[model samples]
Target: MRLFTIGFTQSSAAHFFGRLKEAGVTRLIDVRLNRRSQLAGFAKEGDLAWFARELCGIETEHALALAPTPALLGAYRAGEVDWPEYAARFKRLIARRRIETQLDRARLDGACLLCSEALPHHCHRRVVAEYLRETWGKVEVVDL
Candidate 1:
Protein backbone atom coordinates (compact mmCIF):
# COMPACT_ATOMS: atom_id res chain seq x y z
CA MET A 1 0.00 0.00 0.00
CA ARG A 2 1.13 3.52 -0.81
CA LEU A 3 0.17 5.93 1.94
CA PHE A 4 0.86 9.65 1.56
CA THR A 5 0.67 12.42 4.14
CA ILE A 6 0.45 16.20 3.65
CA GLY A 7 -0.05 19.42 5.52
CA PHE A 8 -1.90 22.48 4.18
CA THR A 9 -0.43 25.27 6.27
CA GLN A 10 2.32 27.47 4.78
CA SER A 11 1.18 26.27 1.39
CA SER A 12 -0.81 28.04 -1.28
CA ALA A 13 -4.02 26.52 -2.59
CA ALA A 14 -2.46 26.01 -6.00
CA HIS A 15 0.54 24.26 -4.55
CA PHE A 16 -1.56 22.05 -2.30
CA PHE A 17 -3.90 20.86 -5.00
CA GLY A 18 -1.10 20.55 -7.50
CA ARG A 19 0.84 18.24 -5.22
CA LEU A 20 -2.16 16.00 -4.70
CA LYS A 21 -2.85 15.83 -8.40
CA GLU A 22 0.78 15.20 -9.20
CA ALA A 23 0.87 12.40 -6.68
CA GLY A 24 -2.14 10.74 -8.28
CA VAL A 25 -3.95 10.62 -4.96
CA THR A 26 -7.43 9.27 -5.50
CA ARG A 27 -8.71 10.04 -2.02
CA LEU A 28 -7.81 12.52 0.72
CA ILE A 29 -8.40 11.48 4.31
CA ASP A 30 -8.67 14.50 6.59
CA VAL A 31 -7.27 13.68 10.01
CA ARG A 32 -7.82 17.01 11.70
CA LEU A 33 -9.79 17.19 14.94
CA ASN A 34 -11.32 20.50 13.93
CA ARG A 35 -12.19 20.42 10.28
CA ARG A 36 -14.48 23.44 10.00
CA SER A 37 -12.33 26.05 11.70
CA GLN A 38 -12.45 29.49 10.11
CA LEU A 39 -8.67 29.71 10.39
CA ALA A 40 -8.37 26.92 7.86
CA GLY A 41 -9.37 29.22 4.97
CA PHE A 42 -9.39 27.17 1.75
CA ALA A 43 -8.76 24.02 3.73
CA LYS A 44 -12.01 24.20 5.65
CA GLU A 45 -14.05 21.03 5.48
CA GLY A 46 -16.77 21.99 3.01
CA ASP A 47 -14.59 24.06 0.72
CA LEU A 48 -11.80 21.51 0.73
CA ALA A 49 -14.12 18.67 -0.13
CA TRP A 50 -15.67 20.58 -3.02
CA PHE A 51 -12.39 21.83 -4.42
CA ALA A 52 -10.79 18.40 -4.20
CA ARG A 53 -13.66 16.76 -6.04
CA GLU A 54 -14.15 19.41 -8.69
CA LEU A 55 -10.56 20.34 -9.38
CA CYS A 56 -8.56 17.24 -8.69
CA GLY A 57 -11.18 14.51 -8.99
CA ILE A 58 -10.21 13.33 -5.55
CA GLU A 59 -12.62 12.13 -2.91
CA THR A 60 -12.35 13.61 0.59
CA GLU A 61 -13.40 12.15 3.91
CA HIS A 62 -12.73 12.90 7.55
CA ALA A 63 -11.30 10.21 9.82
CA LEU A 64 -11.63 11.48 13.34
CA ALA A 65 -10.30 8.20 14.61
CA LEU A 66 -6.93 9.35 13.35
CA ALA A 67 -7.08 12.70 15.17
CA PRO A 68 -5.69 13.46 18.54
CA THR A 69 -8.22 14.06 21.27
CA PRO A 70 -9.08 17.62 22.27
CA ALA A 71 -7.25 17.30 25.58
CA LEU A 72 -4.16 15.81 23.96
CA LEU A 73 -4.02 18.53 21.35
CA GLY A 74 -4.57 21.24 23.96
CA ALA A 75 -1.71 19.97 26.05
CA TYR A 76 0.61 19.84 23.07
CA ARG A 77 -0.31 23.36 22.02
CA ALA A 78 -0.03 24.65 25.58
CA GLY A 79 3.56 23.37 25.79
CA GLU A 80 2.76 20.94 28.55
CA VAL A 81 3.99 18.20 26.24
CA ASP A 82 6.77 18.23 23.69
CA TRP A 83 6.72 16.74 20.20
CA PRO A 84 8.18 13.42 21.27
CA GLU A 85 5.74 13.12 24.17
CA TYR A 86 2.85 14.14 22.00
CA ALA A 87 3.81 11.63 19.34
CA ALA A 88 4.10 8.89 21.91
CA ARG A 89 0.72 9.69 23.44
CA PHE A 90 -0.87 9.85 20.00
CA LYS A 91 0.57 6.49 19.05
CA ARG A 92 -0.81 4.98 22.21
CA LEU A 93 -4.20 6.54 21.61
CA ILE A 94 -4.38 5.09 18.10
CA ALA A 95 -3.25 1.71 19.32
CA ARG A 96 -6.02 1.71 21.92
CA ARG A 97 -8.45 2.75 19.23
CA ARG A 98 -7.28 -0.07 16.99
CA ILE A 99 -7.13 2.16 13.92
CA GLU A 100 -5.64 -0.59 11.85
CA THR A 101 -8.94 -2.41 12.21
CA GLN A 102 -11.08 0.72 12.02
CA LEU A 103 -9.88 1.93 8.62
CA ASP A 104 -10.40 0.21 5.33
CA ARG A 105 -7.13 -1.08 3.97
CA ALA A 106 -8.23 -0.72 0.36
CA ARG A 107 -9.34 2.89 0.87
CA LEU A 108 -5.86 3.84 2.06
CA ASP A 109 -4.28 2.89 -1.22
CA GLY A 110 -3.37 6.05 -3.16
CA ALA A 111 -4.83 8.08 -0.28
CA CYS A 112 -3.18 11.02 1.38
CA LEU A 113 -3.63 11.91 5.04
CA LEU A 114 -4.28 15.63 5.55
CA CYS A 115 -3.37 17.90 8.44
CA SER A 116 -2.53 21.61 8.98
CA GLU A 117 1.04 21.50 10.29
CA ALA A 118 2.85 22.41 7.01
CA LEU A 119 5.27 19.52 7.63
CA PRO A 120 5.25 15.93 8.80
CA HIS A 121 8.07 16.21 11.32
CA HIS A 122 5.90 17.15 14.30
CA CYS A 123 2.49 16.22 13.00
CA HIS A 124 0.15 13.44 14.02
CA ARG A 125 -0.33 12.54 10.37
CA ARG A 126 3.19 11.18 10.22
CA VAL A 127 2.62 9.19 13.36
CA VAL A 128 -0.55 7.74 11.91
CA ALA A 129 1.20 6.80 8.67
CA GLU A 130 4.12 5.22 10.49
CA TYR A 131 1.84 3.35 12.85
CA LEU A 132 -0.18 2.02 9.96
CA ARG A 133 2.96 1.01 8.11
CA GLU A 134 4.20 -0.83 11.17
CA THR A 135 0.90 -2.52 11.82
CA TRP A 136 -0.03 -3.48 8.26
CA GLY A 137 3.45 -4.02 6.88
CA LYS A 138 4.39 -3.62 3.21
CA VAL A 139 3.16 -0.01 3.31
CA GLU A 140 5.26 2.62 1.61
CA VAL A 141 4.72 6.03 3.15
CA VAL A 142 5.40 9.18 1.18
CA ASP A 143 5.37 12.57 2.85
CA LEU A 144 3.93 14.98 0.34
Candidate 2:
Protein backbone atom coordinates (compact mmCIF):
# COMPACT_ATOMS: atom_id res chain seq x y z
CA MET A 1 0.00 0.00 0.00
CA ARG A 2 1.34 3.43 -0.91
CA LEU A 3 0.93 6.13 1.73
CA PHE A 4 1.16 9.90 1.44
CA THR A 5 1.31 12.87 3.78
CA ILE A 6 0.20 16.33 2.63
CA GLY A 7 0.58 19.81 4.10
CA PHE A 8 -1.84 22.71 3.62
CA THR A 9 -0.30 25.51 5.58
CA GLN A 10 0.91 27.69 2.73
CA SER A 11 -1.44 26.95 -0.09
CA SER A 12 -4.83 28.17 -1.11
CA ALA A 13 -7.70 25.73 -1.25
CA ALA A 14 -7.39 25.58 -5.01
CA HIS A 15 -3.71 24.76 -4.87
CA PHE A 16 -4.20 22.26 -2.09
CA PHE A 17 -6.95 20.52 -3.96
CA GLY A 18 -4.93 20.58 -7.12
CA ARG A 19 -2.00 18.89 -5.48
CA LEU A 20 -4.20 16.16 -4.17
CA LYS A 21 -5.67 15.64 -7.59
CA GLU A 22 -2.23 15.53 -9.13
CA ALA A 23 -1.19 12.98 -6.58
CA GLY A 24 -4.34 11.04 -7.37
CA VAL A 25 -5.31 11.13 -3.70
CA THR A 26 -8.66 9.47 -3.26
CA ARG A 27 -8.93 10.14 0.45
CA LEU A 28 -7.47 12.68 2.81
CA ILE A 29 -6.94 11.92 6.49
CA ASP A 30 -7.21 15.25 8.21
CA VAL A 31 -4.65 14.79 10.95
CA ARG A 32 -5.00 18.12 12.67
CA LEU A 33 -6.09 17.75 16.29
CA ASN A 34 -8.39 20.73 15.91
CA ARG A 35 -10.54 19.99 12.91
CA ARG A 36 -11.76 23.54 13.25
CA SER A 37 -9.17 26.28 13.20
CA GLN A 38 -8.90 30.07 13.04
CA LEU A 39 -7.45 29.79 9.55
CA ALA A 40 -9.78 31.11 6.90
CA GLY A 41 -10.55 28.19 4.65
CA PHE A 42 -9.71 25.50 7.19
CA ALA A 43 -11.82 26.62 10.08
CA LYS A 44 -14.66 24.15 9.62
CA GLU A 45 -15.13 20.49 8.91
CA GLY A 46 -18.21 20.91 6.69
CA ASP A 47 -16.58 23.55 4.56
CA LEU A 48 -13.48 21.54 3.81
CA ALA A 49 -15.60 18.52 3.14
CA TRP A 50 -17.67 20.46 0.70
CA PHE A 51 -14.67 21.90 -1.02
CA ALA A 52 -13.03 18.53 -1.37
CA ARG A 53 -16.15 17.05 -2.83
CA GLU A 54 -16.97 19.90 -5.18
CA LEU A 55 -13.48 20.66 -6.35
CA CYS A 56 -11.35 17.55 -6.21
CA GLY A 57 -13.67 14.61 -5.90
CA ILE A 58 -11.38 13.31 -3.16
CA GLU A 59 -12.97 12.13 0.05
CA THR A 60 -11.93 13.68 3.35
CA GLU A 61 -11.94 12.04 6.76
CA HIS A 62 -10.38 12.87 10.09
CA ALA A 63 -7.53 10.63 11.07
CA LEU A 64 -8.18 11.00 14.76
CA ALA A 65 -5.41 8.69 15.90
CA LEU A 66 -2.89 10.02 13.44
CA ALA A 67 -2.93 13.31 15.25
CA PRO A 68 -0.42 13.47 18.06
CA THR A 69 -1.73 11.74 21.14
CA PRO A 70 -1.67 13.41 24.55
CA ALA A 71 1.04 10.98 25.48
CA LEU A 72 3.18 12.40 22.71
CA LEU A 73 2.98 15.81 24.36
CA GLY A 74 4.42 14.47 27.60
CA ALA A 75 7.16 12.82 25.62
CA TYR A 76 7.88 16.05 23.75
CA ARG A 77 8.29 17.92 27.00
CA ALA A 78 10.74 15.28 28.12
CA GLY A 79 12.62 15.56 24.83
CA GLU A 80 11.46 12.18 23.68
CA VAL A 81 9.74 13.51 20.53
CA ASP A 82 13.11 13.88 18.90
CA TRP A 83 13.12 12.40 15.45
CA PRO A 84 14.39 8.84 15.75
CA GLU A 85 12.78 7.72 19.01
CA TYR A 86 9.41 9.38 18.56
CA ALA A 87 9.33 8.20 15.00
CA ALA A 88 9.78 4.64 16.18
CA ARG A 89 6.94 4.73 18.68
CA PHE A 90 4.65 6.73 16.43
CA LYS A 91 5.30 4.37 13.52
CA ARG A 92 4.25 1.42 15.61
CA LEU A 93 0.99 3.01 16.63
CA ILE A 94 0.13 4.48 13.22
CA ALA A 95 1.23 1.67 10.97
CA ARG A 96 0.98 -1.51 13.01
CA ARG A 97 -1.90 -1.04 15.43
CA ARG A 98 -5.55 0.03 15.50
CA ILE A 99 -4.61 3.32 13.90
CA GLU A 100 -3.92 1.38 10.76
CA THR A 101 -7.56 0.44 10.69
CA GLN A 102 -8.49 4.09 10.31
CA LEU A 103 -5.82 4.69 7.70
CA ASP A 104 -6.88 1.55 5.96
CA ARG A 105 -10.40 2.79 5.63
CA ALA A 106 -9.08 5.94 4.06
CA ARG A 107 -6.82 3.89 1.79
CA LEU A 108 -9.75 1.86 0.55
CA ASP A 109 -9.98 4.77 -1.87
CA GLY A 110 -6.30 5.92 -1.76
CA ALA A 111 -5.24 8.15 1.12
CA CYS A 112 -2.83 10.67 2.51
CA LEU A 113 -2.26 12.15 5.95
CA LEU A 114 -3.16 15.86 6.05
CA CYS A 115 -2.09 18.61 8.39
CA SER A 116 -2.19 22.41 8.59
CA GLU A 117 1.54 22.75 8.31
CA ALA A 118 2.66 23.79 4.84
CA LEU A 119 5.98 22.06 5.11
CA PRO A 120 5.94 18.31 5.49
CA HIS A 121 9.48 18.16 6.89
CA HIS A 122 8.51 20.37 9.83
CA CYS A 123 5.31 18.58 10.78
CA HIS A 124 4.45 15.42 12.68
CA ARG A 125 3.51 14.01 9.28
CA ARG A 126 7.21 13.87 8.59
CA VAL A 127 7.72 11.74 11.61
CA VAL A 128 4.90 9.48 10.54
CA ALA A 129 6.38 9.26 7.05
CA GLU A 130 9.69 8.21 8.49
CA TYR A 131 8.01 5.43 10.39
CA LEU A 132 6.23 4.49 7.20
CA ARG A 133 9.48 4.29 5.32
CA GLU A 134 11.21 2.28 7.99
CA THR A 135 8.38 -0.20 8.05
CA TRP A 136 6.74 -0.05 4.63
CA GLY A 137 9.13 1.68 2.25
CA LYS A 138 8.59 3.51 -1.07
CA VAL A 139 5.74 5.81 -0.16
CA GLU A 140 5.13 9.33 -1.47
CA VAL A 141 4.45 12.50 0.54
CA VAL A 142 2.76 15.40 -1.22
CA ASP A 143 2.53 18.88 0.31
CA LEU A 144 -0.65 20.31 -1.10
**Against the true structure, what is each candidate's TM-score?**
0.99, 0.73
Provide the lDDT at 7 for model 2.
76
Global Cα lDDT for candidate 1? 0.97
lDDT of 2: 0.68
Top model number, TM-score: 1
Per-residue accuracy of model 2 over 27-75 as CA lDDT, tens digit each: 7777777777657465267788888888888778876777777687469
Listed per candidate, the RMSD to the true structure in angstroms reads 0.5, 3.4
The lDDT of each candidate is: 0.97, 0.68
Cα displacement (Å) at residue 92, model 1: 0.3
Candidate 1 clashing pairs? none
Q: What is the C-alpha lDDT profile of model 1 across 52-105, one tens digit per residue? A: 999899999999999999999999999999999999999999999999999999
RMSD of 1: 0.5
**Total clashing pairs in model 2:** 0
Clashing pairs in 2: none
